[model samples]
Target: MSGLVDKAKNYVAEKVANMEKPEACLSQVDFKGVNRECVTYGAKVSVKNPYNTAIPICEISYVLKSDARVIASGTIPDPGSIRGHETTVLDVPVKVAHSILVSLVKDIARDWDIDYQLDLGLTIDLPVIGNFTIPLSRKGEIKLPTLKDVFHKK
Candidate 1:
């Protein structure tokens, strides 16, 4: 009887391992806007659902790092749901304080941009599969707006 139970567990594990899972990627990160206190950047994430039913997103957590230092981190709860058989795009806003940018002047002066790594966790609830997290990471450089660009009239 114990052997039979062990075999059943192994079968279930194998099935789960072979199941179709959702996939996601960080598409782009760009400067969004600037406010009095901080500059905001938007990170775009594309998620593809493989199941036939819509999956509810549990949470989206993100960390923005530069020079191996965390510059922004936050969690977005219950952002929405991923459509079945289609791709959904989500936007995550990251705010970095003006003071923080000032501290990195040396790096900015060299290339007029900031190099960054964005780490994201996309959690979704799959039927009969519980909650699963799709981890994504992207590295790139974002060009900073020059004084003329900021003050230029549209």
Candidate 2:
């Protein structure tokens, strides 16, 4: 009896492991806008849904780090649902406090850019599998807007 139960468990585990799952990737990151309080950046995420029906997005959480310090982190709930058998692009906005900019003087002095690592989790509710989270990460330098770019008169 125990041997039969073990075989059944193994079969279920193998089936779960071989199931086709959704895939996600960080497509791009760019500056969205700057306000008096903080700088806003947008991360474009692309998700490929393999199911035959739409899946509800539970949440999208993100972390932005620079100079080994966390610049911003937050959770965006219920961004939307992903279309069936198609790719969806979602924009995640991150706000960095104005006070934190002062702490990054070292990187600013080296270059007019910030070396950053963005970590994002795309969570979706899937049938049978329940909830699944796809973790995505991106590392690159984001150039700060120069005085000309910021103060340019239209």
Candidate 3:
């Protein structure tokens, strides 16, 4: 059980990291509302297991930071499942995705040079379902993107 928990945690972390990496930018971003800051991205995941067992539950959390201090925090508990015995990543949750995206947009929007109140929309894409064949096969450690990277313009 301990091993499974650790693997799950690591998996979530990696997914989140990859999703926000600079190189991972969505091919095209559509802005909405009067403010261009308002944007949305969507994601989905599928899972496959050898035994057809229900996908293990995953919990995700979002923490907003500023000046190295936490400004807001939220969590998505066992948002969804990857489906049992399926060999694909499942779409788990969206709230955390939205929170992170909104936080990023809001940060840049607050800049004096940028006059706007951002209302962000987000989508998370679940790529190939990881190989969870072995009890300890899954890795869960991820280096999260800093607030600046998520919100700042390069």
lDDT of 3 at 48: 40
Error of 3 at 122 (Å): 18
* Cα RMSD (angstroms) for every candidate in the order listed: 1.8, 2.0, 14.5
Give a tens-digit lDDT track for model 1, residues 1-154.
9999999999998999899999998999998778798888999999999988889999999998888888889999999999989999999888889888888888899998889999999999987689999999999998887787667767
- TM-scores for all candidates: the values are 0.91, 0.89, 0.28
Clashes of each: 0, 0, 28
User: How much is the lDDT of residue 108 in candidate 1?
Assistant: 94
Candidate order, lDDT descending: 1, 2, 3
Whole-model lDDT values for every prediction:
0.90, 0.90, 0.35
**Model 2: clashing residue pairs?**
none
Better model by TM-score, 2 or 3? Answer: 2
Which residue pairs overlap in candidate 1's backbone? none
Native-referenced Cα lDDT, model 3: 0.35
Among these predictions, the greatest TM-score belongs to: 1
Using TM-score as the measure, what is the rank order of every candidate, best first? 1, 2, 3
Worst 10 residues of 1 by lDDT: 145-154
> On residues 1-154, what C-alpha lDDT tens digit does candidate 3 reach at each position?
9999999999988986664211111121122112233222222323344344444444434333343444334445555544544554433221223343445554545551212211212222234544222111111111233455356665
